[model samples]
Target: MIRRLAAFARPFSAWLAASAALRVLHLALGIAILTVAARALAAGADAVATAGTIVVLAAAKGTAHYGEQYLGHRVAFTVLARLRTDFFDALARQAPGVLHRHRSGDLAARATADVNRVEVFYAHTIAPALAAVVVALGSAGYLAAAAHPALAVISLAGAAVSGLAVPLLGRRPVRQAARRRQETRGLIAAHVADTVGGLRDLALLGAAGRWERRLGALEERAAGDTRALAARLAIRRAANTAVLAATVSAVAVAGACLWRDGQLDRQSWWAAIAVTLAMAPALTAVEAFAGESGTTVAAARRIFEIIDVPRPRVPPPPAPAPPGPSGSAPPRPAPPARAATTGPATTTGPTIIGPTIIGPTVIGPTVTGAASPAAAERRAAAVSARGVGFAYPGSPPVLAGVDLDLPPGSTTAVLGATGSGKSSLGYLLAAVLTPTHGTITLDGADLRDLPEDLIRRRVALADQRPFVFSDTIAGNLRLADPGADEDLLWHVLETVDLAEAVRALPGRLRTRLAEHGADLSGGELQRLSLAQALLRRPALLICDEVTGQLDAATEARLLDRLRRDSAGRTTVWITHRPATLRAVDQVVVLDAGRVTTPAGPRLSRAGAARPGLSPAGSPGPASLGDTPGPRGPAG
Candidate 1:
């Protein structure tokens, strides 16, 4: 934890240095005030003279302290904000790999609860801890200047105890407290998120009351942990206070003895009192360090765990990508889809290789009846993955050994039972999950060796039960293409057959899609997901069981559009039903995580074979069963 904390702070050394300087100035002002007060008291000073000096000293010290607070907090908060940014961005980029291994609530706890704990260390603990040392040394110097050099040693000993000893004594208990708090918070988040996500399931089963009782018990455990920590915290405070009182009493007795022996003067006598008073604030400040000590440890461990997550192999930079016509290639395997290997590769000036440019256009020999323009366009082939394998962090291999190649300009259907690693295959081929054991390539080139941002613009997936932001349809699409014009946006909407529905809405392009898209029907939500995938215009499109709940007609319409728009593109559709598979060019079957042979059907020239059933005795091809039905995975 400390190592990671050091790493977070490493980038802001300048701010730390400035904060330290302010702390020194602030301490100096405080010491000056203490010295003036002691001198006035020791010299049989006049009431008015003493009052004036003390007031001026208090004002100067207070201003310095205020400046120190502002500067230290500002710098710490800025660093903390940056740390939060780094943490969140890294988590976003890292989530694809980590999600399979971790629970959503657990991750949230780390990102939010754990990161917030570091603030205490930055805002309160660090500067004062350093300032405590400076004040102790400065007080000793002040005492030495006042006639008793030995008193400086006495002050140093007390400051050292408060700065170092107190925290060390509390370390074990504090660490345990922090770990308990962190773990409890994660458990609570996990339970709550699980309950909320599966609300429909619980309600349907009449298990809602049971789940609440269960989650209530977990919440009580978390609260109990807090109570336990508070109890220990109080004990630590008592111990620290007792030691402080003892130290002060001993010092006072020593001062009196020194004065009796004539070794200490009136100045030394009064200085002792002022120095001892400073010890209380300095000692009270140490408690902050002890308190946050546990949280910092927890946060550091959480952060380190995230950083250790494995990332997909980054693809090499595209070789000075060719600037094809329109700087956009057709969705076929050779050109536009190569961009999907990483994403759409961008080129500034005219070049040789471009993502959007349609590869060499073939002119077929024309008989009296040649292929229609739409058929010929649909004939454009897209990229395919031959063999893929993957495994989550703790689980056994997800895709043990799977071999399948997706054809260009065709929708390929994949089916399997739950936990058979169906979704894992979609993510792997889409470059969202890097195969641990096998290679995945686009246009016959390895995907891991491609630039990532380029992949997002070219290859994309709409997940099962997709999330919709509380924003307009246009706002949602803008996330895919930030500069998407209203015309292009509407065209994509119409392409997905949502134009009628979108137009009927009160605000149309400006209408808000309420949170979770609760207002939209399952069919509309599925179509909306389709519209999103269309907006990307990706060379390769991955739909992971996203259409498992719509009515047959709606499903048919959506699948038909998917097939139509798939022209010049490669499409992979994960499903359990055989009906949807009938429209696609080929079908891949996964059983226990391995691919079966003889790609199901070649729907290119001929129509769907064997009605609704896939060629291999699979269920109806268009199973929208994955549409978050009664079985929401039960967490």
Candidate 2:
């Protein structure tokens, strides 16, 4: 695990090596100054000369120390920045999908706190550990040659006790405590974020106090973990100090015995003691790192967990087949009238690729003999689905073997009971979720083959709950098309029946909205989302219950505007309301994971009753009269 974390530092190898070298220089210089000063004093050397030498060594040591710190921090901060970027990139690769499994607070904690904690390894641990080992061995070797071999053993013993033994003794317990502390901190962060985001809802439900108490409990657990870790660290410090004292006492006694035996001179005896004292600073530095190692490792593990997530891969486009004898490509087979429902499906056409684009587009070959001249002029892309199925991770299938063939410039409504996968279908169509089985084609091209930017530019989805940034009205709309001008903005707003509402505001288009559009009514917020989507002039527009919050009059007016906009674009409305049915040209009903319609003959014109949808008179399994509940995993 440590080796894996260290790999991230490979890009900064030069800086790391320089930092470690400076640290070793700083320690060696300090040892040299002490030994020279002690020997000079014992030999009654010139005080001025010794003082000058000491001053020079001290200056060099100070410079080395500064360089070590500068290089260490520079490398640490740069790695931190890169780690943050990689983390977000990982999130983007699996998003909307991963968001269902991970909490916002936990992810935020990993990004901010965990990544910051790993800095300890770079700025504090690496160089100091290297320096301690090098200085300790050098000091022991010097004592063996210049003073007494026995004294060398004492020096090495002291260094080992302070730098290695004490840390190893407490490693397991300290590590466990550190891991617990990190987990607790993540939970606390998640709780705090959840509390703040839903404060209003909690208050209205009279559960604010309960939520506050829960937060307090989480904070208490974190504090307890921290205290456990600190206790282990305190014990290590006490043990290190006792070991140092014992080594020093043994060194003093052995040196006196050697002097009595005429094996050591006064000058050398003093120098040996100075050498033993020099190991104190380096050993103590090592011990500090030991106490922090547990925390550092725990933090690094969390960071790597995110960084190692595999990014979604886009498959290579299908290979084109050789032309037939007539010098023309053979006609592709038509999709199955109804999708098969056994375990895995047999693909009779193009191989299916799951959610590969950032957004959705309906493209490819035109529906032959179906699109009229007026509809063809609209330049809308044809959307078809053959045996498409979808399921959330570890959940039941939401959509299975569902077939759709929406012609260009047509309006279709998809209706389903709660958990019937209405929203899931919309998301699949938008390329936000991947299908578990079957292919979804835009024109003739598989959605997986289209570039992300092209799909985003051509497709738009306006759902019931749309995120609104805290910015001016015009600023928010510009997110859809950054280059959209004021006139075009107003025109799209008018298309969504929101122009008059904006004019009534004090700041008009410039009026700032609170986060998530909290300042606006639900209907206005829905309209705002619709307006943004319309501004894109997408080839295919998907509105998932966008008018659920509006009054009948507003919805009526908005639908009227949508009909005008629909003249030149494909539209899909996913809803359960009977009223929504009146605005659509055809209706498709989903039950359990299959598409079913009242017995009817397939029609030829775009938006006419087809194999996938029931005609106006026949009722599907889920009648419009059924009361709609909260959407499920299928949704």
TM-score on alpha carbons, each prediction: 0.81, 0.79
* lDDT per model vs. reference: 0.64, 0.75
User: Which residue pairs does candidate 2 place in steric collision?
Assistant: 355-434, 363-442, 363-443, 364-442, 364-443, 364-444, 365-443, 365-444
Give per-residue CA lDDT, model 1, range 527-561, as digits (tens).
68877877777778888766666655656566655
In candidate 2, where is summed lDDT lowest over 10 consecutive residues? 351-360
What is candidate 2's TM-score against the reference?
A: 0.79
Please write out the lDDT profile of model 2 over residues 151-216, one tens digit for every residue. Answer: 999889888878888889779999999999998898888898888889889989999988989989
